[model samples]
Target: MEKIERGKALKTGRDYEDIKFRRKVFMSKCVKKAMSLFRIVTLIGISYIVLSPMISIISRAFFSESDVYNAMVYLIPQNGTLKNFKLAILRMDYWKTLGYSLLYIGSLAILQLFICSMVGYGFARFQFPFKKLLFGCVILTIVIPSYTIMLPLYMHFRNFDPLHLFGLLGIGAKNWLTTVKPVY
Candidate 1:
């Protein structure tokens, strides 16, 4: 049967199904577009949140001493200068310090990667005595604050001695605090 609307005849069976299918397709397209937009906006917001600190630090680096002291200035500097960078390099031996820091950090990173990889492999492939306890200890170390272990570390390095050899030789305890060993 055909239906007459606005002086136009509309097919009732196959045409009706075709119309419904087109509407559904159009609605699905709109929904997909909206979801894509929402995802893009969300990711952009997260990226900004993650990058804001680095942006703030980089902007602050251009500020002069006066600009730093001024309560009115925050992000935009009135008297921008590279004086801070120059002072850090010349007066504070920044290059030497940076090189040493990079070396120390790089070594530590490599060591950590190797050690963690081995431990992960062991956990994945093998079963050992105290396996659960060891895993729990590792997790506990990750969950707990490093500050809790600071006292013990300080005490150990405050007068570092081994096998009582230093005491036997009358050399006394050697303080490792002055070295970069404890800083890591």
Candidate 2:
């Protein structure tokens, strides 16, 4: 029994000093491979868990009337049909809504493009006093959440509606949304 400064201590009468070292290396490699496989299995399991409900709902939507209830409950369908598609389209009023949405989106896009281009051009080209300050103020307004001003805006619209001010221009108060002929 003697203590050495550097190398591993050797036993007097055994032919297996390196056996433990070999076992440690083998175990570490196995553990690393196992962990990698475990991670891949976990990710696949999570994907299936997350997408199962969506897939089930879409499949159920195609099931026939008699099979729909069972399919929804069991997440399987023995029969399929297109009745859901017809009901969905009828409830949504697809064509009418599509036309109205297209018109609304077109007008909104044109107005936004014109206004943004004009504002951007002004900011880039103009040299009025306090221009940078005004730009900073506008940027601040954009960055700020609108919920802060929503109450104030609601109160202003309710109390000081511009439609009522049309009386000052000798126009009678009328439904502004229906007839938008300007009075100001």
Candidate 3:
């Protein structure tokens, strides 16, 4: 080995290979650490964004009315009370409201599930005309923005006269806006 030392003891063969190996190892470790730190920060930021609203709502529920007017009150209320909770439950008749809501939502969910399952079964068991096209449409609906169809749907329901049956009875296209008939 020729001893040439301007700064580092520049090595040849095995020593130089070892230095290269060490550099590669260090670089890999640094990259791994950077990636992990990035992932942790990303997760934390997303979690905060998703959870902060729920946290704020729950925190506010625990707060007294005085806390709302107080500028100093923040995440934790200075004087907390269950009055808000009690008043809401009492005024709304919480149990009855919850029961009705759950019944309505559950029935809708079950009906939707049943209809989807029947459609799926029909698709799987039968080979009908334009089957592929229909399936493509079904799949496409998942990707399509709902708002794209909303205007057409709104217009259809807005001027719904169903075979001119209502028109025969001297009634014109009925505006079914905000009516429960459209829900069905």
Candidate 4:
């Protein structure tokens, strides 16, 4: 057996092997430390990105009108007030607005959840004609931007006529957008 000394050239095969093993371990430790540091930096950056808008909005909500206009006050308002919240509640008709919003959004979310689940289950379990085409159409809908279809949808709903059936029946086109029928 040969004794290995730090910062000294290897005198035997055993010493060389020992030095190589030590070098490998040292390199692995350095790499691990570097990776951990990198991970911490990346997490911090992501946290900042996600939280920055929320922090700004919360800070701004507390700011007075004058504080908002003042150039000296940036993130933290010099003087904070609840007047903004009071004004918002008054102007928005808090209870009625909240009720309507909850009714509309909650109904839509519940209906969408059930509808999507049923559709997904059908897709998974069924073997039907034109399934591929139907799936392709679904994919196409997902791929297409909502804004692209918004104009056509708006126009259709504004003067909703189904294949001129209303014209044949002598019933005039009803504006779906004007009525609350579309909400249901």
Candidate 5:
């Protein structure tokens, strides 16, 4: 039935094909336009949601310290300035912290994805003793909160001192940031 209409369309004077193609182009254009709008709206919404608080904070930071303190009691300040930025930079070292956070998060994501894919492939393809148990353990680890191990991890790292290894690598495990020597 569809084929017959297409056949008749082909026979007709460019009406069916032209109309069909135009309709397709129109639909495609509409879809693309809608998608573009959606992307823009989504981006704007996300930016507004994320940046509004930061903007408010930044504005407040520009006010006189006394003014800022007073404003905090009521509504936030509208003023903005370099003093707050300078003070913030001196105190927090924003760039360094941001870099560390990015590196940590990026490494964790890559490691998790790689390990999951490899382990999933192994579980899907291979048979081993207590395989289900091992998989369950992996799943459990994923679900369990990492905050639970904070103190244990802190203690482990604190206690972990490599006598010769530190000298060889020119790195003390205590401070990774100050090390000029690469870890071996």
Candidate 6:
């Protein structure tokens, strides 16, 4: 009778272990499924945010005048045409404008890249008097809206002056707006 009771006890212990194993497997599967769903949702949201504007712009570019007026036209234009591209190229004088832009803006951009790198290196490596104040000014310039300073900057450019030195030197204010000197 004791041997039979010991056999029954071992059988119940094995059943308990089997139940625990099944529960662990079920929980892991649930966790994995939840994580996958979260990832899918996040990807869809990011796709919509990034693609919506680009899709709208492409659709609008292809849209006809009648398509713009039609309320039902959305996402896809009913009458697509390359007329807009031709008009834009002709009106803007594409080649000449592109050449001028590449010459001026491209040079400035390269120069700016070098200047900024040197300035950043200086700021990162050196400690100077008024360093914090100068850094603060740089931050302020970045944070402040360009439009707020636009009028004053425009006026200053129209009559270039540096710390009243030009005035003291008896040199007349030079108009920088007419020249590419402002790029410097």
**Cα displacement (Å) at residue 67, model 4:** 1.6
Model 1, 87-108: lDDT tens digits are 8799989889999999999999
Q: Residue-wise lDDT of candidate 2 within 1-184, one digit each (tens)?
A: 2443456665543325456666889999999999999999999999999999999888788888788556344565677678889998999998899999899999999999999899989999988999999899989989999999877765654434465576677775544333444332
TM-score of 6: 0.57
lDDT by residue (tens digit), candidate 4, 1-184: 5565678876778777887899999999999999999999999999999999999999999999899899999899989999999999999899998999999999999999999999999999999999999999999999999999888888867878899888789998878787888776
lDDT of 3 at 82: 96
* lDDT against true structure, model 6: 0.88
Computed on alpha carbons, the lDDT of every model, listed in order, comes to 0.89, 0.78, 0.91, 0.90, 0.76, 0.88
User: Better model by TM-score, 3 or 4?
Assistant: 3
Better of 2 and 3 by TM-score: 3
Better candidate by TM-score, 4 or 5? 4
Preferred candidate (TM-score higher): 3 or 6:
3
Estimated TM-score for each candidate: 0.60, 0.47, 0.76, 0.67, 0.41, 0.57
- Candidate 1 vs candidate 2, lDDT winner: 1
Error of 1 at 136 (Å): 9.0
Task: Show where candidate 3 strays beyond 4 Å.
Answer: 1-11, 122-133, 143-148
What is the Cα-based lDDT of residue 138 in candidate 3?
97
Candidate 2: give its CA RMSD in angstroms.
9.2
Per-residue lDDT of model 5, residues 62-147, tens digit only: 67666766735434544445787888888999999999989999999999999889989999999999999999998989898999
Candidate 1, residue 50: the lDDT equals 100
Pitting candidate 5 against candidate 6, the one with the higher TM-score is 6
Q: What lDDT score goes with residue 45 in model 3?
A: 100
> Residues 80-114, candidate 6, lDDT per residue (tens digit)?
98999999999999999999989998899999999
